[model samples]
Target: MDQPWLKALHVAAVLLFAGGLLAQSLAVAAALRNDISPGVLARLRQWDQRVTVPALLTAWAFGIATALDNGWFGAGWLSAKLLLVVALTGLHGLQAGALRRLAFQAGRPPRGLGRAPAAVALALAAIAVLAVAKPF
Candidate 1:
């Protein structure tokens, strides 16, 4: 593929991934607010497993491809953004762990687990802004 088209697709994938995370964060908040039925929670988990996970994986794959194609390196803003992305990925794993634990516990979800989604959302928003502005 042409470099420009590849870059565009990579950016689009990143936007979709970040947007999906934000939507999931909002859904988690809503679930916490209202009484979340088991069926709804289960469906949400299923959606995350089926949709969000694969989208995120694809986004990361495309992002790496773009970076390699473009020779990404030695830029302060890009470095910062990459670090933030790593942090966001770690938070995602943490959130998944929390969800699994909650599912097994068969009790109310831990309130602290809420922080993971919120933090991931904030990080993603920051990454999006930085990507657009590229402020060092």
Candidate 2:
């Protein structure tokens, strides 16, 4: 309920989202060469459904809570950070789609998706800068 604890939980959610995305990205990349093994695909699906998705939702929920709690919704820097968060959310959607496709792959899973994790990393870095510096 307190601001500090709420912010800490938001950060933890962000970290969970990032880690899950990283693992999913790597797994998808591996699937590009060959069909992901059923076992691996199952695990990946479970992670996506149970962990990754929930973490992302939690991050968004807590982020909005923090922003409104602290009266930060109208700041220029927050707008930029929100844009980056949208980007991250879009990437998350695409990754989820790719993972779904991987589940149905007969062979030769999708390629050119290896860049997703890197993009997420970049987005996260930019968001961190905006949050810390609020330079706008």
Candidate 3:
């Protein structure tokens, strides 16, 4: 694929993945406070499985491809962006686990989990800055 097209796809996938993470963060936070119906949770899970996870994978794949094509490996900005991306990916795993536990059992999420949305937003903003500025 052309570089520009690859970049566009990567951007689109990242947007979708970020939106999914935000949605999951809100859903899990809401589940912590009250009783959301299993049916609704099920639907959200379906969306995550069908849309969110795929977007995440696509983002990763295209991102790696773009970096390799451009010889960006070992660059400071890419390294920082990669760290943030890893953190976000791990957060998604936690969110998915929380959703499952909430759907299956009656319990609250771990403390501080409610602040995930803010953390995600902060990390995402930093990632954008690093990617755009490439300041070492």
User: Highest lDDT: which candidate?
Assistant: 3
Query: Which candidate's TM-score is highest?
Result: 3
Better of 1 and 3 by TM-score: 3
Model 1 CA lDDT for position 98: 47
Sort every candidate by lDDT, greatest first.
3, 2, 1
Supply the global lDDT for candidate 2: 0.84
After superposition, candidate 3 runs with Cα above 4 Å error: none
- Which pairs of residues collide in model 2? none
Question: Which residue runs does candidate 2 get wrong by more than 4 Å?
Answer: 106-110
RMSD of each: 2.6, 2.0, 1.2
In candidate 1, stretches whose alpha carbon ends up further than 4 angstroms from where it belongs are 27-34, 106-110
Question: Comparing 1 and 2 by TM-score, which wins?
Answer: 2
Clashes of each: 0, 0, 0
TM-scores for every predicted model: 0.77, 0.88, 0.94
Taken over the whole model, the C-alpha lDDT of each candidate is 0.68, 0.84, 0.91
Candidate 1 contains a number of clashing pairs equal to 0
What tens-digit string does per-residue lDDT give for candidate 1 at 34-122?
55555656666777787767777887887787777777766677788889998876656655554554456544445655565668767
Candidate 3 residue pairs in backbone clash: none
